[model samples]
Target: MASLIDNNSNVCSMEEEIEAEAAVLKQIQNRLAEKMEVGKTAPPTEEEQKEIDARSIFIGNVEFGATVEELEDHFKGCGEIVRTTIPKDKLTKKQKNYAFIEFESSDSVENAMVMNGSTFRERQIVVTSKRTNKPGMGAQRGRGGIRGGIRGRRGGQQTVVVKYVYVNGAAPRGRGGFRGGRGRFNPY
Candidate 1:
């Protein structure tokens, strides 16, 4: 009879431990859900909004060796350049073939647009106004908005499918025998 009672006590304690663990798991899941909801609904701060509204232009197809001085010289006649930013690769520290040029005023944006399709370093460059999208605002067209509408499905879950094609494995002949392949040595 004593052994039976001991077995019952052990089973009851195990059930209680399982219940406690389940409650802890439920609490963690609730906290994660709350954090996600907050992140989705939070609005941009004042500084971020100002940055989004700043008069800037995105320059694509920039030459890998292009310098900020060259960009300033190209747009010097248009208007005062407030700032310039050229994103570089993390490992290579080379230009990512794009840059952002902020002008003193919105009017300068139009002036800078005249350089669209112009040649720089033997490559035709594209210049366009830079803009940001506010959350929950849907698609806002015209100058500053992103090109085309933001495409998404319900529940905010997206699945991306990618396909890669391999070309002939030959080292491209140019620019001091730089091997042109998808690796650390290749700058392109």
Candidate 2:
């Protein structure tokens, strides 16, 4: 009789715990919905507008085999495509899984934005405005950095010295010559 009572209490406690978890989950869902509503009602700021240009759209999750022609065809209804740029791997020369599409007008950007989360080549693609970096902005170049090329301090300004190294038709020759004294240092 006592064992039966204990089992009933355990079941009741389990049901109460489940109800409590469900209530918490419902609260979280409500908060998320409210936040989403707030975002939808708020207008984008001027700085954000400048950062995300009106005519450029970023397409993400592009398939490896997807071509520029296919992308143009898919977005034909949006508007006239001015240009499309798909960055490739420097060494492999393969598509980088994302592309930037520039439209003829800002209306095209708005049209494309409506197609966010749309299907493309069996995958849902993310479409968003392309963020543009202003001139003289972004990461500060380090001294002697290869990207900005060996910058030197001059008067209160930094001057970059660009050097180009060229190798002629013949193989490069070192201090020991082309073949490089192979048998000179022998280990027995």
Candidate 3:
């Protein structure tokens, strides 16, 4: 008799088990639907987006050989220099021709822009408010590349230089592998 009772208690029929689970799931779904009625959290306000958009001053046309120290020295007199960055080439590890400089205040940044467009060194400095470097940057150049090599339809060349390129990856047929110099990866 004890064995019979134990066996009956141990086994719940599949239909009953499924019904129990379905009921619990229904409750959870209802709760989730009710919560969703509160609506998605409103998107961030314009002011918040502006704060996100507001970036540090970006300095371009930097002399390629210029170091971080030289950049600081050149711009320090303009205002409190917060940070300076000179990006290096990916493979060569040498300085790229551009840099980014952050000032302590926006006012100082504005002043620096006014004081520094086409300012002479070896070449004229192209100083302006820092903007995202994107494909459109060349369009702003008015001709073609940075120097506006191509002429636009308006008789005067559009300074904007838009360069479009496409690359195809075709694996080499011979024993020469994709990565010859880099050896196998070993993590200790």
Best by lDDT: 2
Q: Which has the greatest TM-score? A: 1
lDDT of 1: 0.77
List TM-scores for all candidates, in order.
0.46, 0.45, 0.42
lDDT for model 3: 0.65
**lDDT tens readout by residue for model 1, 1-188:** 99999999999999999999999999999999998898575676867656645678999999989999998888888799988888999998878999989888888989989999988889999999887655677743432342322343233333344344445965444332222222344344
Off by over 4 Å in 1: 1-53, 133-188
Candidate 2 local lDDT, 2-79, one digit each (tens): 999999999999999999999999999999999989857565577755643768999999998999999998899999
Q: Backbone clash tally for model 1?
A: 0
Off by over 4 Å in 3: 1-55, 118-121, 132-188
Provide the lDDT at 170 for model 3.
48
Question: What range of 10 consecutive residues in model 1 has the weakest lDDT sum?
Answer: 174-183
TM-score, cand. 3 vs. native: 0.42
RMSD of each: 16.3, 20.2, 14.4
